[model samples]
Target chain A: MIEVINLRKSFNGQEILHGVNLKVNDGQSLALIGGSGRGKSVLLKHIIGLLKPDSGKILIDNEDISKLRGRKLKRLKERFGMVFQGGALFDSLTVFENIAFPLREKTRMRASQIRKTVSEELAEVGLSGAENKYPAEISGGMKKRVALARCLVMSPEIILFDEPTTGLDPLIGKAIHTMIRSCQKSYKFTSIMVTHEIPDIFSMVDRVAMLYNGVIHAEGTPEEIQTSKDPVIHQFIHGELEGPISIN
Target chain B: MIQILTLLRIIGAFVIFVIRETGRMGIFLAEAIFWIPFPPYLFGRVVRQINFIGVKTTLVILLTGTFTGMVLALQIYFTLSKFGAESRLGPIVALSLIKELGPVICALMVTGRAGSALAAEIGIMRITEQIDALDTMALNPYKYLIIPNLIAGVISLPLLNFIFVFVGVWGGYSVGVGIMGLSSGTYFGNIRDFVTGADILEGLYKSLSFGMLITWISCYKGYFTGYGAEGVSKSTTQAVVLSSVTILIWNYFLTSILVA
Candidate 1:
């Protein structure tokens, strides 16, 4: 479970998020659909404790994580697996070490155990034989899967995917969506995915929140999001330029 | 009063930044040092850096060492010759090569080669988001990136200093005795008389501190580098500049403190 209250953020004097509040119950899948530079990634980073909001409280499992610092913050961070916008795999490390990273860091599992767990997770992601390859050696879709495998390796209770399908082809993106739905069901994880792929996310999400003008203008189920009377949300969902959203 | 307050505030912020960054580096250093206590050592990465990042730059070190020794010999000879003690060239060159020239030259050379490369590599890693990946897995990027380089730089500089002194003294010897037709007896005797245990200790001490300085600055700049590709290149250049300046500045102060 994750909860954020009145989250306000600014970068260098420009406000990005203005009093945004949201929450997800245990075992819920929520999708945040927004245009670029709309604070989705920033908000996700705050939840991950990678960045702190100017004012707001982010609670994970009822613990305040927004202001956590030092080693304490790092330990809190290890609890959740995150698939970044890019795969973000270490260039120098093999896929085995990449996925095994969390297990090795957070647990006393030996190398043999780590190898076994990493392979299992890789297999779960359909990347079993690709373990020895580096990120550069893999396809974009495979890299994302490796990232997801790493995220799920700790058996983390929650997973955050930032634009999981941003750079993938349409077919690959659909495969990723299948993986998301199936994995979330199998793992029973509380998932918050920040994405711009409205249709793919709408098809997979239980609920949706549309961020606009530094606030969540609408929150609803998939049908409510598509048919809502809210100009910003409707225009974004419909990909229409005739509404309040500027063409630029 | 406002000027003084502003100055104090700037200093406060700088101090805080250093403290915060230092703490980041320290936590990482602790984790890295802890892993050293266990089996399946990750020194493979460290050894790669030492071999590629440190050893591959030997030619540059040799070039800088030889020229530096030659310059020191010329300067000391000119200054001491005026006092009709031109024979002091051997002693002056020996002392300079052993104490100051050796470590400082080696540090600068390594900074140009290893320090810049280390900074750029980490800076690229930072810009490319690879380090952020480590964070997601609960693996500390600072530990994985900074500590190994810090230890490598710390451990490598002294070894490099030893090489620099040996080659630099040989270069100085070549110029003073071989090229200048000075007798080997006078040169070797002067060196034997002039070099002391304290002097050698002083140079090693300066080298250790210089190692720490170059490694810290380069690693910090690279670790926190903000921009993208442009930022990586900028940090690389900045690392060299900062490391070199820090070395020169610290060399003087450290020599004065530890040597005098």
Candidate 2:
């Protein structure tokens, strides 16, 4: 389980997150939805110990991870995997090498063993024959799949997806969503996804939380969120621009 | 009073900027040094970087060294000819190339070629969030990226400088002994008489320092590069310019100290 309480963060004296609180139970998938640039990504980074909060507590498995450092932080990170918005594949590495990176760096596995494991994970992510291809050589959707394969190779206990379907076509986004759901069902890792895909992804996740004004404005199951009467939730879900939600 | 205050503010800001950059560079260097001995040592990356920084740059260094030596020989011959001592061209050209021009020119070339490329590559990685990805994966960017290049730079520049000196001396030889009508024996003899082991060692030391400086400045610029394509471009430009300027400035200090 991951829990964030009173998380406050600022950059150059401009606060992006203000006393945000949230929780994800073990083996649960929570989709964090928000308008673009509303500190969704920043909040995710805080959970994973990538960014330290100014004043708050992030309890991962009931241990305070907010102030962890050095090897302790590294150990904490080893339990989580992240799929970045841009795929964030190593531009210099081939897909196989990229997927094989974490294993080679963090484990004692021999090259032959790593190759076999990487091949297996690649197949799991539906990228069986794309191993030798560089990230630049593949389509955006395929790159996202490759990123997923890389993340899955570690078999992390938790996975964070940052705008995984942002740049892909609708069909590709749907395919990625299906992949994530199926992979989660099989792997059973806790997932916290930051996305804007709306009703499309509602069927795929267990719960939905709307982040508004630097805090979670609504939290409930997908059905509960879908039937929400809150004006902000209604405006955001239906893609209505002229509502209580203003772009400032 | 307002103008004076504005001037003072500008000066204060510049000083703060300098101090901030220096502190950042210092911390980066310390981390790079600290992680040098830890496990998961990236031997393949170091070798690849060395090959890229050293082997791929051979032709440019060779051409630059040869032409520089040729020009130096020609000019030195002309200058000595006025005093009827044109035969002294060999020692003058050899000394200058080995002691100063070899390291400085080779470093400048590598700065423009390899240093700028490194900064741009890393800057692109930075903008694309690859560095953050490394952090998420429990990988140290300093160990994985910077250290290999740093090691490669330290190893590559001196070897390149040696090639530069050899090619440059030969360039001087061909011009002085072949085209300029100076006796080959006199030319070779002058070089043998004046050029010492210390001169060679001095070139090596200068090249070593130049390599570290170029790589350090370039990598630092890239690691802390700002956001977006514009940021990467700006970092690359700053990397090359800063490396060149620092190399020249440090070369003067190094020369003065080494000479003393």
Candidate 3:
């Protein structure tokens, strides 16, 4: 289980997160939806220890993450994986090398075993013969899949996706969503995805949380959030511009 | 009075910023040094960086060293001949190349070639979140990224400086003996007599320090880069400029102390 209590973050004297609270039980998939620049990525960064919160307690499996430092923090972080918006694939590495990076760096696996594991991961992501290709040589969607394979190769207990499907086409984005749903079922990792896919994301995630004005405006099952009557939630979900949520 | 106060305030702010940044850079250097002795030594990466920062830089160093020596011999030959002291040309050229010009020029060239690229590459990684990705993977960016460059810089600069000085001496010999009609024996003999162990060691020390300064400033700039393409470009420019200026300024102090 992961719990965030009164998380707050500020940058350049402007508060982006204001004592926000959230939680995700073990083995559950939560989709964090919010307007652009609403600190969705910031919140994800805090959970992964990328950005330290100004004030709050982020407890991962009941261990306070903010308090952990050095080797302890690194040990805790080993249990987590993050898929960045741009895939964050190492540009210098080939697709196979990218997926095999964590294993090579962190594990004592033999070359044959590492190759076997990477091949299985590539196959899982449906990029079976594309191992030798570099990130620049592949399409954006393919890069995301490679990123996912790399993340999953570690079999992390928690996976964080930061706007994973932001720039892909609708078909590709849906394919990615389906891949995530299938992977979640297979890996059973606790998942939190920051996305703007709206209705498409509803079916993939078990729970949905809407962040507005630096706080989680509403949290519930996908169905409840879909049918929510709150003006902010309705305006955001339906993509309506004029509502309690300011466009700015 | 108000104008003077405003100027003082501006100077105060600049000083504070410099002090803060220096402190931060010192801490960064400390952290990079701390990770040097840990496991997963990354020897391959260090070699690759040495190739990039050292081997690839050899051609430019040779060209510059040769021309610099040639020019020094020609100019010094003319000046020394006027005073009936042309016999001192070899020693002057040898001493200048070994003690001062070799390390300083070689470092400046490296700053332009490798230091700028290091800053830009790491800055792009920063803006693209690759650094964050490394952290999330339980990999220390300092280990995988900064330390190899640090090691490579320390290893590469002195070797390049040696190459520069060797090539420069021959360059000077070609001009002093081959063109100036001086005895090759006199030129060689003067150089052997005048240049000492301390002079070569002084050059080695300067090169090593230059290496550390170039990589340290470049890596620090890139690691703390701001957002986007503009940020990367700015860091690259700053890395080159700062590394070059720092090398020159640092060479002065090292030379003063070594000479003393």
Candidate 4:
């Protein structure tokens, strides 16, 4: 379980996340939805200890990950799997090497074992023969899948996805969505995915939370979010350009 | 009074910028030092970087060293002929190549070639969030990305300097004894008699220091690159310019101290 209390972050004296509080129960899939640049990704980065909050408490499994440092922080990070908005695969490394990176770094597994594990993960991600391709040579959707395979190879206790399906076609996005749904069902890792995907992701995730004005404006099941009376939530969910959200 | 105040403000800002960058670099260096002895030392990466920095750069260094020595021999031979001291050209060219030009020019070349690439590569990684990915994987970016390059620079520069000196001395020999009609016996004898072990050691010392400086500046720039393609370009430019300027400045001081 993860608990974030009063998380606040600012860049260049402009506050992005202001006194935001949220929680994710163990083994649950939560969708953090927001308008573009509303700090949803920032919140995910905070959860993974990639970006520290200016003022907040991030309790991961009851331990304050915010206060962890060096070795302690590294240990805390081992619990996390983050798929960045841009696949963020090491451009210098091939798909196989990238997927095997964490395992090689953190464990003493033999070469045969690593190859087997990487092969299995690739098969799971449906990227069996794409192992030798570099990140630049692959398609964007394929890169994201590779990133997912890399993230899953570690078998992290928690997973954070930042706009996973942002740049893909509808068909490819659906494929990625299916992959995520199946993997989540099997791995059952606590997942927090930040996306503005409508209808499709709404059905995939168990719960939806909307962030507005530096705080979670609404939280409930997707049906509850879809039917909320708040004009902001309605406007956002239906992709309307009017209501409380200013286009300026 | 307003002019004075504006000048003071500019000076203050410059001072603060210097302090901030210095502190950041110091902390980065300390982190690299701390993680160097830890497990999973990346020998393969270090070797690869050495090949990139040293072996791949052999032709450029050779060309620069040979041309520089050839020119020095030609000019010095003419100056020496004015005083009927043409044989002295051998010791002058040999000493200059061994004690100064070989290391300084070789370092400058490598800085332009490898240092800029290092900065740009790391800066691209930073912008693409690969550094953050490393952090998420429970890996220290400093240990994984930086230590190998640093070790490679430190090791490769001295070896490159040795090659430069060897090629440069031969260049001077070819030009002075072969091209300029000086007696080969006189040229070889003068160098053998006048040049000492300390001259070669001076070049090694300068190369060692220069290697550390170039890698440090380049890596620091890349590691702290701002954002985007523009940021990567800026960091690469800054790394090359700063490392080159620092090498020249530090060379003057080192020469004064070493020679004194």
Candidate 5:
């Protein structure tokens, strides 16, 4: 379980997050939907302890991750997995090496064992054969899958996805959605995914949270958000210009 | 006056931040170095970095070091000969090359070749959130990225300086003997006479110190990059400028304190 309470963050004096509050139960997927520059990424960073909150606590598994530091902080950080939006694979390492990275760095597993584990994870992602190739040689969707494999290598309890399907075509997007659903079903890990695509929310998500006006404007089941009578949620879900929210 | 004081304070803050961060890096480096004696080591990455950083720059360091050594020897020889103290040229050439010129030149060459590129690459990784991704996955980026880079730099710079001094003094001896018609034996004997245990240690010290400074500055810039591409360019530029300036400053200080 993870809880965010009155989280506020600012960059260069311009307040980005204004007292946001959220929570995710165990083995659940909560997609935070908002427009670009809506502090979705900021909130995600704070939860991962990437961006420090100005005030408030981000509690992961009953521990306040915000106050942790050094090796202790790093240990807490190890419990979470983050897939950067652009499929941030290390270009220098091959796909096999990339997925094997966390296991080698963090655990005491032998080389042969590591090799077996990496192959298994790659197969799980449906990317078994491309292990020898560099990130640049692969497709964008494949890179995301590799990132996903790397994320799972550590067996994290809570996974954070930052715009996973942003650049891929719709066909690949559904495939990615399926992959997400399948992984969640198997692992039963809590997940917080930041995304803009409505279809993704409709097809796969169990619950949705709408972030607007620097706070969670609405939160309910996917069905509830889609059928929301509130002007802000309705306007946002329909991608309309004129509503209770301004263009800015 | 108030504005100046505020400006000075900002600069002081930045310096303090650099000092603290570098100290943290040094502590991490010490722990990692301690692990070097343990078994199951991988020298593949280290060897690759050495080849890329040291072996690749062999010709450039040689050319620059040779010219510098030759010029220093000739100028000192001419001036000392006019004073009927020509034999002092041997010690002067050896002292200057070992204590000052070799390390400075080698560091500058690397700052130009590898340091700038390192900063840029790191900056890109930081901005693109790759490093952060690594961190979230329970990986010690210090182990994977910092240790290899720091070790490669520290080992390579001194070896590079050794090459520089050898090539440089040889160039000087050849110029004094072949081109300027001085006796070859006399030129060789002078460098040999002047090179002491202290001089060799001083050069090695300078080489290692400058290597640490150059690599750390570049790494730090890249590690904390902001503002995307523009930020990356800024960090690379800052890494080169600061490392180059610090090298010259440290060379002067080390020479004054150690050699004097």
Candidate 6:
């Protein structure tokens, strides 16, 4: 389980997150939705200890993440896998090596075992036989698949996805969503995804939280969020220009 | 009075910026040094970087060393002959190459070739979030990305400096003995008499320190790169300029201390 209490973050004297509170129970998938530049990624980074909040307590499995230091923080991080917006695949390594990277660096597995494990992961992501190709040689969608495969290879207890489908085509985006959903079922890890996929994302996630003006504007099941009458939620979900939520 | 106040403010801000950046660099150096002894030692990566920083840089070092030596011999012979001190030409050329020119010139060249590339490569990784990804994966970015380069820099520079000096001495011999009509025996004899072990050691020390400075500045710039393609390019430029300038400035101090 993860809990964020009264979280706040500011950059260059401008506050982006203000006393925001959120929680995700173990084995649940939560989709964080917000307008552009609403600090969705910032919040995700804070939760994963990538960015420290100006004031807040982030509890992961009941331990305060912000208070953890050095080896402890590293140990905490080992339980996490984050899929970045750009896949963040190591450009120098081939697809196989990228997926096998964590295993090679952190584990004592033999070469044959690593190869077997990587092949299985590639097969899971439907990236079979694409092992030798570099990140540049592959399509954006393929890169995301490789990123997901790499993340899953660790079997982390918690998974964070930062705008995973942002730049892909609709079909590819949907395929990625499906893959995440299937992987979540298989891995049973706590999941938080920052995305803008709207109603389509509703089908995959158990809960939806809308962030507005540096706060959680609303939080509920996907169905409740979809049918919400809150003007901010409605305006955001309907993609309206004029509403309680002002556009800059 | 207001104009003076404004000027003071500008100077104060610049001073603070310099102090802050120096402190940051100091902290960066400390952290890099701290991780040096920790294991999961990546020997293969170190070897690869040495190949890039040292072996591949050999030809440029050789070419520059040769020309520099020839130029020095020609100029020194002309000046020395006017004073009837032409016998000193060989020792002067050997001393200059071994004590100063070899380390400084070789370092500047490596800064251009390998140091800039290291900055740019790591800058791209920073902008693209590969470093962050490594952190999330429970891997230390310094261990994987930095320490190897640091080790390579320390290991490669001294060897390359030796090559530069050796090639440069022969280059001076070719000019002094073959072209200037000085006795080969006199040229060789002068170098043997005047060049001490301490001079060679001083050169070694300069190269080793230069290696550390170049990689340290380059890695620091890249590790803290701002945001995009523009950020990467800016970091790369700063890395090269800063490393080269620092090498020259640091060489003066090192030479002063070593000579004393």
Please report the candidate that would top DockQ against the real structure. Answer: 3
Residue-wise C-alpha lDDT for candidate 3, range A1-248, written one tens digit per residue:
99999999999999999988999999999999998998999999999988889999999988989899888998999999999999999999999999999999999999999999999999998999999999999999999999999999999999999988999999999999999999999999999999999899998999999998899989999999999889899998999978887876
Q: What is candidate 4's lDDT per residue for B32-122, written digit by digit as tens?
A: 8788998778899899999988888999998998888899998888898999999898889888988889889999999999999999999
lDDT of 5: 0.85
**Model 1's DockQ score:** 0.56
Show where candidate 5 strays beyond 4 Å. B1-48, B84-86
The two-chain DockQ for each candidate, comma-separated, is 0.56, 0.86, 0.91, 0.90, 0.67, 0.88
> Ten consecutive residues with minimal summed lDDT in candidate 4 chain B?
B32-41
lDDT (0 to 1) per candidate: 0.82, 0.92, 0.94, 0.91, 0.85, 0.94
Stronger candidate by lDDT (2 vs 6): 6
- Reference-based TM-score of each model: 0.88, 0.97, 0.99, 0.97, 0.90, 0.99
C-alpha RMSD of each candidate structure in angstroms: 4.2, 1.5, 1.0, 1.4, 3.4, 1.0
Q: Indicate the DockQ of the complex predicted as candidate 2.
A: 0.86
C-alpha lDDT of candidate 3 relative to the true structure: 0.94
Candidate 5 positional error at B4, Å: 11
Off by over 4 Å in 4: none
A125: Cα error in model 3, Å: 0.9
Better of 4 and 6 by TM-score: 6
Model 6 lDDT tens row, A1-248: 99999999999999999988999999999999999998999999899888888998999988888889878998999999999999999999999999999999999999999999999999999999999999999999999999999999999999999999999999999999999999999999999999999889999999999999999999999999999999999999999999998888
Question: Tens-digit lDDT track for model 6 on B175-226?
Answer: 9989999998899898999999999999999999999999999999999997
Question: Among all windows of ten consecutive residues in candidate 2 chain A, which has the lowest summed lDDT?
Answer: A61-70
Query: Clashes in each model (backbone N, CA, C under 3 Å)?
Result: 0, 0, 0, 0, 0, 0
